[model samples]
Target chain A: MSRKIVRIAVPVLVLLFLYVPILILALYSFTDATQIGAIRSFTLKNYVTLFSTEELRSMIVGTILLALGAALLATILGTLGAIGSFYSRKRTSSAIATVNQIPVINADVVTGFSLCILLVVVFGVSKDSYIPLVVGHVTLCAPFVYLSVIPKLKQMDSSLYEAAMDLGATPAQALFRVVIPQILGGMVSGFSLAVTLSLDDYFIATYTKPATFDTISTYVVNATRGSQTDIKTALWALSTLIFVLVIVIVGVMNFNSGRAQKKEAEKA
Target chain B: MENNQNIIELKHISRTFEDGFRAVSDFNLEVKRGEFVTFLGPSGCGKTTTLRMIAGFDMPTEGEILLNGQDISKLPPNKRPINTVFQRYALFPHMNIFENIAFGLKLKKMPREEIKKKVKKVLELVDLEGFEKRSVSTLSGGQQQRVAIARALVNEPEILLLDEPLGALDLKMRKEMQIELKAMHDELGITFIYVTHDQEEALTMSDKIVVMSEGKIQQIGTPEDIYNEPQNAFVADFIGESNIFNGIMTGTMQARFAGGHFQCVDDVPEGTQITAVVRPEDIELTAPEQGQIRGKVISVIFKGIHYEITVQSGRYEVVIQSTKSAEVGSVVGMKVEPDGIHIMIAENNTNVFPVDMNRNHRLEFNGTELDTSLTQLIKGSRRNEEHELLDENGEVIDPEKIHIIASIEPQDIRMTDDVDDEQVLIEGTISNLIYKGDHYSYVINTDLGQDFIVDDEYLWNMDDRVGLILPLDKMRFQVKK
Candidate 1:
């Protein structure tokens, strides 16, 4: 009985440790407290400021746009890379897999600095253009997409492509009609992962974004370092909103996967 | 050219993989229009490879493929008038049955209404009517197989290639599918090229059967001809149950084997080495005195329709299948009519036996340890410091997985009159002999029932006891992976 208590208590403690700070911030965002030390009466003032402020709104919108664009590009490139490698010869496929692993394991700072150097210094591409920023995020997210897609490709029946060909579909038709649908689930998950990764990234955006524009991550870092009390408190509301959005997304994904599993079991 | 009845012809086709493994070699076949030809062989015997070549999925490395007298060797699969039903029923899981069947029709830009009608008609052909709009995962294995066949047949190709399409089904379902598929073939009258390792399925469904072994065709004939007159020992053993014995022609119409003389129908010259084949069902059991050869019944097994009996006569075990039952341990006489025996000139008169290799890389034959090492079995293979055999890739090969067959030519074996000689490996009685131009070929039957065909220059009397001297240098070993 004591052992069971430890097992339950251990997880409860760990979860509390991880979520207490976020919970405190959310609670404070509802109150008129400018700082965490004191909690005043409840108000919607912080949430109003978070939406009414033009800089914060544009920054959030720009960050989402950047994430969507980068995630789209990353999903395409990564899916193509995975499919090409999956169909290649054994040696070539394994070599490509090994090469794709380096970026996934490498430090984000190194990738950001090297991409900045390659695009902004040697290539002389101006920072005023957001090319380096989008390239940096795509580089960061594409390998992860490839990693997600490889497993789905491996799980799929390898003969489906041949069957399509045997049934009079051309090579491209087979790939688009038969092969793509089988791995579309992985591609979707990979796209979502890329969006999240781009949203959470700070170092790559800081090094690569245009001088005049700012993403949420870069703006948050600058905002936290300033002495603007009102804006700081409003950021709390933004964090709460982001956290709620994440929870909703994760819950929906889990629910969908669970339903899919149940359906599969019923079919069997 | 347009009036030719041959649908597809494979001319001297060979396929060698990148790793130097030859999957098919010098294969040639002409598939007549509307002929239900089956490529029958054990797995990895190039039957599926040949089928793939015909389906335009694989290109032969050496030869051309002709479709209606036009060379289409380099044509893509989509360009060919062929469709294949895969072994695993590779149906699109994301699609409904209607969409799956209408895929090829859609590619051809057929009208939507016509596509639906065609799908409905083909589904009816496969007896899967009213299955449209159902997801693939909701179907049973047999149902999925029917969907696959319907999907292939809806295209109306000139030829349909089926690569063991019923291999995944249970026996009863497979039998049902076999009859249904044959009926479908007859109704459609389309050419069908099938690949299967099951001999019974091949014999039951095919108009022409091509038996293959080790990337080569052994025989191509009708089912009746293949079962009645197999060209080689491989075909004879693979097609059905037969009692094959190493024998020699004693006279114009007589052959001596299995320690007894019997009259055969083959008109081979006297003193010629031959292999006599007698089907199990052709042998009749009788009283000991009224039969050609006598033996004691060792086992009697009741099959569903007949009784299978094994008789041990001298150093031979003859298997006989009959409707009547026989008492085990009772002596009985077995007789084969003159026309029941099928004889062929012996292809290889060498003595070959399976040998095992121990961890120490020593060769073991018939449970007796020999002085030969495992490396001697395969040339270019060497033993490492740990006494494990290393293949050409320097990889340690498992001794148990390698099938080692040691063979000694008839000319390489020496017979000794002294049964207790030190160099003698086995002692046996002289069962049969054939006189060649300058030498004599003898079949020695050991007590373990193994036959050793040896070529000797001197004369040996009948029933004389002799010991075999297998010289170490004269024996050749082959390793089958």
Candidate 2:
């Protein structure tokens, strides 16, 4: 009985430790409180300021667009790399797989600093062009996408590609028609991961972005250090909104996957 | 126009992998139009490799493949007018049955209505009518197999290559599909080239069967011809149950085997070394006094349609299949008709196997380390104290890069009854025996799946556990770069 109590108590304590701060901030976001440790009158003024501010709205839009573009590029490169490596000879494929893992396991700061050096110092590409920014994000995300896609390729029946070719489809046609659909699930998860990685990244963005541009992560850090209490409080509302969106998205994903698993079980 | 009947011809086709493992060697076959040709062999016998070469999935390392008298060896699978039904039904899981079947048609850019009509007709051909809208995952294995066949057939390929399409099916479903596929072939008049390890399936379906073993074709003949007239011990053993004995011609129309002299249909020069095959079903049991050879029934098994009896004579165990049952331990005489005996010239009486040179310059074969040196493999080469072999010019020879083949005459290897004897180099079971005039040639199969042929003047009973002693002086080694 005590062992069972420990098990339940431990997990509850850990979860509480993780969510308590976020819950407190969410609760405060709904009020007109200027600071924590004090309760002010209930109001939607923080949310109103969060949406009405032109600077915050543009920065959020710019960050989202950057993430979308980078994730798209990363997904294509990663999927193609995975398919190419999977079809290569054993030695070449394993060598490619090993090389692809280095970026995934390396420190993000190191990756960002090196990209900054390579693009700014060696190649002399202008930082204002946003090429280095997109390249850094793709470098950070593509390896992760490749890692996620390889298992799906391994799970797929390899003969399906040959079957398509035998049925008179060209190699490219077989790849697109038979191979891509089977690995689409892995690609989707990889794309979402790339997007999340791009959004969460701060060092790479800071190193590579233009001096005038600011992502949410950089803006939040700058905003907290500034003396503007209104914008700071508005950030609480933004954080609350992002947290709620994540919860809804995760919930829908779980529901969809559960239904898919149930359908697979029924088919079997 | 006389050559028009041959739709596809493989001339000296060979496929050696990058790692130097030969999958198919010098394979040649002429497949006639509308002919149901089957390549029959055990797994890793180059049957599927040959099929893949014909299907354009694999390219041969040497030789050309002619499709309607035109070389298509370098053509890709899509460019070739051939389709293959894979062993596992490789249906597109994301597509519905209709879309899967119409994939080739869509690639060809056929009209949508015609694609549908063709899909429907092929689906009915495979007995999967009205299954167009069903998703691939919703179908059973057999249903998916039909969909695969329908997908391949809907394109109406000039040649249909089946690589063990029914290998995944259960016995009953396999039997059913065999008949259905044969009927489909007959109705369509399409040339079918099939690869299978199952001999019964080949016999039941094929018009011509190519028996292959170890990347080489052992024999190519009709099913009746393959069964009744096997060309070698491998074919005799693979095609069906047969008692193969190494015999010698004593006189005209007379051969001596299994401790008995019998008249055979084959006429060879007297004293010629030969291997005789007698099928189990062709041997008749008679009273001991009236039989050509007398033996005691060691075991009897009821085999659904016949009783299979194993009779132990002096040094041989003869398998006989008959409708009548025999009591175990009862004496019986076995008589074989003259036409029942198939005579084949004995293959080379030497056992040759590939061996690797170890770091110590010793030879290794089939997990057994032999007391042979790499220096002995090359003439005028000697191993130094550092274990490196040096040639006559004193240049070091890399043992790792060299390929060593060891060959020993059958008579140079002796077998001992003590299986656990440490002095012996290998231990095996006596799988087969043939009496060749003054000596008995035995096929000893080791647990490692290597067969070593040895000839001894002394008689040994079949299935006797024995250890082989290879005399080093009598063993010859060949070194290849």
Candidate 3:
């Protein structure tokens, strides 16, 4: 009984350590605080101001669009690369996989700085272009997609493709009908990982973005640093909203999975 | 034989993998329509390779495969009118049972209604009619097997290949499926080519059995022929329990071995040497005065139907299966009828010598000319003095020359019993002694840089120096091209 209490208590303490500050920040969204360190009176004035402004809302939209675009492009390219390399010769595929892992394990600042040099100094990319920013996001996200997809490919039965072909399907038909459906779960998980990573990124975005285009992370950093305007409480509202959305999504998935298990048990 | 009646013919098929492994060698067979044939062997004996070649999943490295008299060796599996039930079933987990069975017809662009009708017909044949809507993963192993069969049968191929299809099921389920598969085969009346290593399964289900070992077919015959009339030592030992004795033909229908002379039913000439095989059930236990040989019982095992008894006679232990139980350590006399003894010419001995007879009536062998009578060289040959070893139609024997192959049986090479004489052909030290069920087979490395296998009824210690005696009648010669 004491051991079970320890197991339960350890995880609870860790969750509190991770989430207490986020909870505090969420509570600050309703108050009229001028800075993160100072407590202030609770008010709805910040929400009203946040809605009245178009720039902040546009920043949020821009960040979302960029993340979605990056995830879409990365998933397609990464899933294809994963399948192609799986059929390639063993030595070449392992070499390619090793090169794919460098960006994932490397420091974000190093990756961002090198990509900046490659786009601006090496390729003569202009400062106001979105190409550099979009390319940078795709580059940062594709490796995570590759990591997710290759394991699923390896887990699939190698004979399934031959079995399909033996059953009168051609090579291309077998690939599309049998192989792709088997690995779709891995591709989906890879796409979600890409999107999450893109949304949380600051260094790569800052290095590649033009001065006129401000993402949420860049806007928040710039807003808090200068005296032109105080950091808005609307940021806290956005954080709390995202936290609640994640919790709801997780709860729904768990409930559905449990119900599926019950149905299968009843069936058997 | 009508050409149309032979559904598939493999002519000199050989397969050598890229990794220097010879999986099958010079395999040839003709499968008649509506016949159930099985290739039975231990693992890596090319049984699966042969079945795969017939199904077009694997192509022979060299040779021709004819399906209905047309060469189908170069065709792909889909192009051939053959379907295989893989060892693992290989059912598509992503599809329901209905879609899985309909996949082939759907590819052919058959109408939906017609495809459904055909799939239902096959499902009923396999006794899986109501399993259409269930997911493949939800079904049991036996059900999955039936689905695999139904999927293949629905295609309506000319021939069906099964590669150890029941290997994954439990013992009881496998037995049930075996009966079901045999019944299905009878109803379909399609040619079935099955591959397995289980002798009992092969004997139970097949109309013909091809026994193979080391990538070569040992014997091909019906189940009764393969079990009762095995052609060689390997076949006799593999098919069932047999007590093989090294014997010499003493006279017409008589052989001498095991320190006793017994009457046999073989038609070999007198003074010829042979190996005799007798099944365990063929031996009779009787009184000492009424028996041919007597020995003490070594072990007795109570098998369900019979008592298996091992008797030690000299250095050999002979196993006998009888309905009457015999006490262990009791002395017993054993007798066998004349028909119980099967004599076969021993083949493929290591002590091989090339011999040829000249027109001058002299034999040249091993760089020595021997004065053997010419009558023995050409005796019982198809080509006698008139053809001079040529065919009767004057078609020269390939090179228009006669060559002879002479082999000395290892068991016939006797060691001198503490006496050295001019008949000592070789002196060697015993290198290894392996206790084959009936006798001790010894490997001897001689001073002349040769190895000889000798089956003896007397125990000899390893590394013992012994002089070998090759009896004149034991050295049998056969005509070769």
Candidate 4:
């Protein structure tokens, strides 16, 4: 019983350590206070200001668009890489998988700095170009996508593809129809991971972005850099809204997947 | 006429995997149209590999796979005019039964109505006509197996390959499916090639059984022929219960074994040695003086229909199946008729040793040397005690090379826990113990990768470390031809 309590207590403690500050920020966002420490009457004025601000709206839109584009590109490339690695000879596949892990394990600051130098000084790309930012985000996300999809590929019944070909389907049709459908669950989780990573990444975006443009993460970092006056009270409301939106999205997806799993179990 | 009748022919086909393991070697067969052929063997015997070759899943490393006299070996599985029901009924779980059955037809760009008609017809043939919209995952194992069959049959291929299709089913379900599959084969009129390790399944459903072992076809014959007239000891032991013994042919229709001479119908030459096979059910239980062979019952077990009794006499234990039960430890008599004995030339059971002798009047064979003055070089002058090759005049001479041959029957091998200086001893691990109806026959592998088949009444467990005592009297020496 004590061991069971330890198992539950460990995760609970880790979750409290990770999310307590965010919970406090969300709580302050609902108050009528101008600062985090002050507890005042509750109001929606901060949310109203957040939605009405043109700069904040553009930053949110830019962040989402950048995340969507990066996640899409990374997911496509990573899924193909995973499939290629899965069928390649054992030695070659292991070598490629090892190479794919570099970006995932590399220090974020080091990767951002190296990419900045490569894009600006070597490639003659301007620091303000969207190319550098998008490429950087993809580099950060693709390894995660590759990591997720490869396991599902390994877990899949390899004979399903052969069975499809035996049933008169062409090679391409077998891959797309039979192979992809079986591993779609892994692909979806990988895409979500890439998108989430791209949304929160600040160092790469800051290093690679144009001076005139900013994503939500970079904008928030720039606005709140060691100054109380520069940081806006409405930013808390924006953070709270994004957090709630992520929670709802994750909750709905979990519920749908759980139902699908239950239905599959019943079918079997 | 032959081309029309034979739907598929594998000509000199062989398959070697990338790791250099030969799965199937020199496999040649002409499968007649509408024939049911089963490739039966233990696992890793290349039966499934041969079936996969026919289905175009595996291309033979050598030779041609001709379908109606047209080579289709290089063709992919999708392009071949064949379909395979995999070991597990690999139905598409996401699809309903209707969609699963219609998969192959839809791939051919068949019209919706035509595809539906074909699917419905095949489903009805499998006796699952009303399970169209049911999800594949929702169906029981047997029902799913039928859907898989319907999926393959709806395409109307010229031949069908089943790789242990009923392996995943329960015993009862597998038995029922065996009969159903045979009926389906008859109804479809397509050449069906099935691979399975189950001997009963092969005997029950196959029109012809191809027995394979270690990538080579041992024998190909009708079920009855394979069961009764097995061509080799492996075939006899693999197919059904049999009491195989080493017998020496003294004359035509006369053989000596089990410390007695018996009459057999085999036409082996006089003095030729052979292995004989007798079925347990063929043995008759009688009084001690009324039968030819007398023994004491070692064990008895009632097997619902008959009693399986083991009788020990001499070095052999004769297994008998009779309606009358014999008490354990009771004296009994066992008799076998002349027609019950099947004789075949021994291959693996015969030991072959190269001839080598040094100059000190020593005969060297199997890493052992023996002092002997009787040495000759396959028709050269004879060697004397002083290493002198003596011609007819007893003069000192030398021959360039000597040829010698050695042969020993498997049962002549004596396995003991201790080594003796008087016997030629070799250490081997008991690799396999195959119970050929009554007594267990062991295949022992020596350190030099040579296998020795030893038959003894003693039941040695597999992987037992034992010493083989090969007495020199049992070893027959002959000049190499």
Candidate lDDT scores, in order, read 0.89, 0.90, 0.83, 0.83
Question: Residue B259 of model 2: what lDDT?
Answer: 85
Report, for all candidates in order, the number of backbone clashes.
Answer: 0, 1, 0, 1
DockQ comparison, 2 vs 3, better candidate: 2
True contacts kept of 1: 0.93
Worst 10 residues of 2 chain B by lDDT: B431-440
Question: Which regions of candidate 4 deviate over 4 angstroms?
Answer: A1-19, A31-34, A39-43, A117-128, A226-231, B1-4, B348-481
Where is model 3 more than 4 Å wrong at Cα?
A1-9, A37-39, A43-59, A76-104, A108-143, A146-158, A203-232, A260-268, B1-4, B246-248, B257-259, B269-275, B349-435, B438-481
lDDT of 3 by residue, B155-204 (tens): 88889999999999999999999999999999988889999988899999
Q: Which stretches of candidate 1 lie over 4 Å from their true place?
A: B1-4, B349-470, B473-481
Residues B1-481, candidate 4: write the lDDT tens digits.
Answer: 5534888889999999887778999998988988999999988889988888888778899989998889999999999888888888888766789988888888888999988788778888999978999887778889988888888888888888888989889999999999999999888788899999999999999999999987889999999999989998888888888888776898889887765677888888987777788899988999988777888899999999999999888767788899999988878777789998898875555776554655654556656775434544334567566656565667653424655666677778888766444464578888666664345678887755577888776788767887887777677776555
lDDT of 2: 0.90
Q: What DockQ results for candidate 4?
A: 0.56
Q: Which ten residues in a row have the lowest lDDT in candidate 1 chain B?
A: B431-440
Better of 1 and 4 by lDDT: 1
Task: Specify the highest-DockQ model's number.
Answer: 2
lDDT tens readout by residue for model 1, B1-481: 3434898888999999898767898999998888999999978789998888888878889999999889998988889899999999999988999999999999999999999899999999888889998999888999999999999999999999999999999999999999999999999988999999999999999999999976889999999999999997778878888887778999998999877788988899999988888899999999999888999999999998999999988867888999999999999999999889998888777789777887767887655578876665577788788877888889888777888888999989999999788788888998666543235668798766678988887999968999888888888887766
**DockQ values for all predictions?**
0.64, 0.73, 0.30, 0.56
Q: How far is candidate 3 from the true structure (C-alpha RMSD, Å)?
A: 11.1
How well is each residue in B36-73 modelled by candidate 2, as lDDT tens digits? 99999978788998998888889999999999999999
Candidate that scores best on lDDT: 2
TM-score, candidate 4, is: 0.85
